[model samples]
Target chain A: MSDTILFDYWRSSASYRVRIVLNLKRIAYRAVPTDLLTRQQKAPDYVARNPQGLVPMLHIDGQDLTQSLAIIDYLDATRPEPRLIPADPVARAATLARAMVIIADIHPVNNLRMLHYLKNEMGQDQAAVDAWYRHWIAEGFAALELMAPENGLFGCDAPDLTDVCLVPQVANARRFELDMAPYPRLTRIDAALQAIPAFAAAHPERVKPA
Target chain B: MSDTILFDYWRSSASYRVRIVLNLKRIAYRAVPTDLLTRQQKAPDYVARNPQGLVPMLHIDGQDLTQSLAIIDYLDATRPEPRLIPADPVARAATLARAMVIIADIHPVNNLRMLHYLKNEMGQDQAAVDAWYRHWIAEGFAALELMAPENGLFGCDAPDLTDVCLVPQVANARRFELDMAPYPRLTRIDAALQAIPAFAAAHPERVKPA
Candidate 1:
């Protein structure tokens, strides 16, 4: 069978993760962009594949996969050579734990729509909204910084799952010009990640949509 | 190996998933409640196990497993008896996809603090905020309902991983008294799930955390 296709949007961090994983694994697949700006996600066809109308849905031989973490893990499971999750169960758990710090804990708190809600609906001033965004990043990063660096170079130098989730969030933080000075370890690990081609190549600007 | 200990708040939808899984597996776990109303999760020691200081930290064989999805999957893998995840590669992707729709899509957008911001800080009345809340749930549930009935009795059948993640969100939706009429299929599955002892016994009130 031929390779699977990925539905993506360049700027979406979730889509960015799938792109990074596909790149890291050296997988050949099509990247289809669903324009977020045009509100295409809310369109009938897009909602059929992903009810939530989110990007980064992977169609592997036709079955649609939602959720970046699930998609990433599925990629790892199907292509196990450069394992994204570590071998030891505990370390794997730790890696996932760190990922949760970013995915479940931090990213959810600072997603695009939430920020919009904070500004348009919550009447939060730009300053308060920015603070709110950074506050969550700082909180999760502090914990991740505390726990990461189990081995050598990157965070959880098994160079596993959590690190994949981390780099994008760090990039997003940088985009907002959130000061990373407070999160020493997270910044350290993120710096290490920046040196890797896999992370750099998968950046949003480099994606097919662009 | 001894059973994992789960520190959870009964009413916390995140914690409720683990309780359901443990029951499904017939795996024994002692439930420790972290007081949400009192903000006990913000306590120092709780912060140590979880840097994010969120409830539903699963202590398994001395390893503190945070993130409900991570914990649930670990059990699904290690135990493997009742297999919450589907076995075929494609089916497995679908299962993960369903779970992610609820976990990544719906829950994050409607979090406690997020809703609180709209209500208290943003000065949107409760009516507007509830509409905002149900809008997301309806968006997600509509997609889930369209899935093959074999996926669960609710969305897919017999309550696989997606259902485990889903039931709690539905519980929260009911708590908010969001109009459940729009998604009759979801309510049908909800009824199917509530009838099962495993899900019924794991309900928030069953946990007895005042």
Candidate 2:
């Protein structure tokens, strides 16, 4: 069995991002589905491995790595093929900035835990939670739409970190029924990325347990 | 006047992270205060430069950069001295993972805009908003405290990305009156980090506009 083990939830956008990177790099790993809906991720055994008790914790290279972007950074650094992040400093910064719009700005606000807090702790209804999710997605996508290139993938040619992050977020956007008309560029990019075998294989539907 | 211009808001944890990096690198740049309180970040002129409409946008090397981590990555790549992110792959991943606990998980949820949404849109009261803020900080710090070193700076000798990210977050925690007693390791590290000139000069109170 491959030493790399990814503890991830099927529907998590963060986990989806890591799965895309792992597929792109052709990294083999055992998948341990830690169902977020069931709070399996917060189990003592899992929390011992990941103090954050968050999914997408990758046990690889003898280190337990948490955080999707950090894991991708490690993969890119170690594998160094089909480079997800650019080598040029300017290009790297620009690419990462785009990724952070989703990673830091949008996804966190819309994360399941945050949504749960809104509902359980703050007494928000389903409609309120759904609106909350859509609000952040639309806000981040508006900026991303402006930032998207007029042509080619986000990385230009093969997909890069920006594309890796963009695809999962787009999936979440669609799940939330966000209006895609305002983000034609991002929609085009997501379509192109989805066609890539690496991204296609990482789709949560493909990995979901029957 | 330096060609590099940093458009940032005082008291912004994300912006404070960038300020620490710039000071550590001894990079001279003009500070253009973009007030968040008045929603100055959404101004069209600023949005034209940074489509994300976020502060901590660094106009450096003739390129406009947004996102605090991405801006720091750019600075680290160019400056190279007092390197914030480690060169070793495993070390880099570990450092980044620590930083992301606060950056992606905590700060994003407790950000000004998110708090505004809870209070204004979700109709949560000030007490609810404060609880929301503290809950995330305590959760993130709990994880980080476990990951913190028993002694020395986060980088052993000098501050790295994790340390850079931590100082600003600790400041925010104090602002929200989070009881730091539980996170002794993180609290110790924050104390050491605060003594550093770079971190001290970047404090929100120090940099606040008259």
Candidate 3:
């Protein structure tokens, strides 16, 4: 089999989400850390490969893919054993919608570049920056909490796309010290997913470079 | 066929993307204008239906779908005549990645609520808010311009998901008075897309409630 290469940052929520899927599928690949703090993703060579210059770019099957959810979709499409996205149309739409609550609405606003812009360009202090971060999480999670099922994980017996997206964002929420009291369902789901070996192995702290 | 209803705001870029696909597929539907400016989306009743309280909540196939891309995915899956998202895995990933540069990165950061927070909560004047809007657009567009093909539309002969996403964001850029001189490729693509009847009919101006 050809080698799979994942260019990712350990601390990136998007990257973390991809890692969980890779681990869940047991797809062995080399992890090339693209440090976002130092802006290594913007290097000319990296830009040549990924025009967006974003991390979590995967090179597999001789194709270079960008965007976390897109990459996940590609992964799910090719590796169908433990499906991350549902195959049924309605089920798939529900899963994608819940997943996008984080991918589109919450994560983008709180990602490193956005935070950097708020602090450097807008002259916001750390407190304000943290507030901005928590604000988005609060808004997104409130809806997600409502959408979350009362029974099992996001995929209801197994982890699906929403579960993959949720773990990383929940990790970020804790990193920013956002309160978890209101999102009991999410907090509980995160806890259950964490106990699963695949999700646990992909934690940012576990993968962080020395 | 059952009735198709879309709860969307005329000016919302996310809502606009969904509109393009619905028109392209020739799906007849009722568009209920959920005004963002008056905080109509945040009303208790709307929130009950769409827990996210976001525009472009679609009702079809006896299901309520949120998130523009997810809704679009559902549409493409059910209505396969003019595929907005590619069926081939590699092509789908590339299309989705390009589309997400706008969907996930640019639009979310510059959405109505984000702008409202900048002005009201963060005390940013209109000028600062406008600069913030232009900054994200410029960053996202620079990457998208690189990914855009030199020849045909985003899908070559027909408009795809990337084209669906690009037209609305380009509309937003023009609304904000952004200088489009740098992104010649994107400008060319947007112009070509707008010439299509499906793209033209989805314009905010055409759909805006009187």
Among these predicted structures, which one has the highest lDDT?
Answer: 3
**TM-scores of chain B, in order:** 0.91, 0.98, 0.97
DockQ of each: 0.52, 0.88, 0.89
State how far residue A125 of model 1 sits from its true place (Å).
Answer: 4.9
Classified by CAPRI criteria, candidate 2 counts as high
- Where model 1 places Cα greater than 4 Å from the true spot, the runs are A1-3, A120-125, A150-158, A208-210, B1-4, B117-128, B148-157
Q: Give one digit per residue, the lDDT tens place, for model 2 in B1-210.
A: 999898978989999999999999999989999998888999999999999888889998899999998998889999999889998999999999989998899998898889989889999999999999999999999988888889987888888899999999988999989999999988888999999899999999998999
Instruction: Compute each candidate's TM-score over C-alphas.
Output: 0.91, 0.98, 0.98
Model 1 complex DockQ against the native: 0.52
Clashing pairs in 1: A122-B122, B151-B156, B151-B157, B152-B156, B152-B157, B153-B157, B154-B189
After superposing candidate 3 on the true structure, give the runs of residues whose Cα lies further than 4 Å from its correct spot.
none
Query: How much is A198 displaced in model 3, in angstroms?
Result: 0.8
